[model samples]
Target: MTAKPPPDPAAPPRSPWPGSAATAPARPPEVTARRLVARSRIFRVEAMDLIFSNGAQRTFERILGGRDSVMVVPVLGAETLLLIREYAAGTDDYQLGFPKGIVDPGEDILTAAGRELREEVGYAARRLCDLQRVTLAPGYIQHGTRLVLAQDLYPSPAPGDEPEPLEVVPWPLTDLDGLLARPDFTEARSIAALFLARRYLQQAHQAPAADGKGRSAPGNASSPSPDETR
Candidate 1:
């Protein structure tokens, strides 16, 4: 039998997966010129002339917005999630998704999430966890939304600027598949938020409780588990 030779020390480490070698990112295209193409009450489009590193030129149009928004996944107890059904102007139909709103100027993300939760779902959360910041159609749109997970809720309804009252719906966390199958729950951002919140909750539940000695704490009959706080 032939013996295998030693590995090359000077060569780069091999990737565990075939054809999955990492490569350096390409240089971003430079903007040669930019001009406002259109403006509306809620949107502004800007046209840009770009020159790529390869000397290729292209004109791109992107939506410009300085403000970011927040979407809250309000966990109404251990298993329920508070969602909203509201008229989406873009679709001209009612869309089912988490409570969300634009973060007001000078307002923090968690605070905006809490406020939107109260306005849309008639509840305020004592605990808020930021899951992630996500963008929609980043190739054209410049808007971002911060996803938040809210818990320990209390009723605190507030008036909002909606054209009509939003219908609040409580969904079970375990029924995420059912929610995903609904046609009205097709918003990409909301779907991403749902998965992110689920992953976070699962990890939190699996984490061992620690004590002062950096050891797992003994389970107490009176103490609530992570599931109970969810």
Candidate 2:
């Protein structure tokens, strides 16, 4: 009789999504909205006239598109991750997460990211990597979040006129696994960014040793170094 092979140790557990484990049947279209009724701030006051679909006349309240922002996944001291705790007026309480801010009109994404990093964390990064873009709430709000990987940080005097009172918090990066295990870490985009940034860092740390070509070590990309972009 032939012996059966053991299951692959690296295989992930079965779940609906890799990170989240909920499963539900696909939902049908809620309504075939053909025209917008109005557009206003705070989501309710309407202004512009609505345009209807040619064939099917459906209508929905016009929604104001939300602004875009950049969030930093800051790694410090080769072992710690930087987070911020601030009062969110919307939530009416203090919340903990990465440093982030809305992108101003006519501003570039990288510049905005750097500005937010410094304003919120009081540190500037020599190297900033574009990680990914995420839509925070597609169902209601239209906010977009651009994830950034910041490293080689140096202290900088914080901008005095920052809107919020942000407190910088640093915890060992190894505690990320424990943090994810907590229910408070359920912010989907933050969790995703945290996981992905850590993975990228690990990969970068394991890349071939820097040679004369001047490639950065894994988890360390070029910025102040060669073979890397700003």
The candidate that achieves the highest TM-score relative to the unseen native structure: 1
Tell me the whole-model lDDT of each prediction, alpha carbons only: 0.83, 0.68
Question: What does candidate 1's lDDT look like per residue over 1-230, in tens digits?
Answer: 12334445678865667676364225567788999999999889999998865689999999998999999998888889888999998999999999998999999998898899888999988778777789998999999999888888899999988889999989999998899999999999999999988877786666566754322422222234334445
TM-score computed on alpha carbons, candidate 2 = 0.67
Which is the leading candidate under lDDT? 1
Encode model 2's per-residue lDDT on 1-230: one tens digit a residue.
12334555577765676776363323322343344455555554223332332333333343455568888888876878888877767767776788887788988777787888888888888778877788876655556788888888888746835575678888688887777775444567778889878877776665566785644455443333222322
lDDT, model 2: 0.68
Residue pairs in steric clash, candidate 1?
A: none
Once superposed on the true structure, which residue ranges of model 1 sit more than 4 Å away at CA?
Answer: 1-26, 212-230
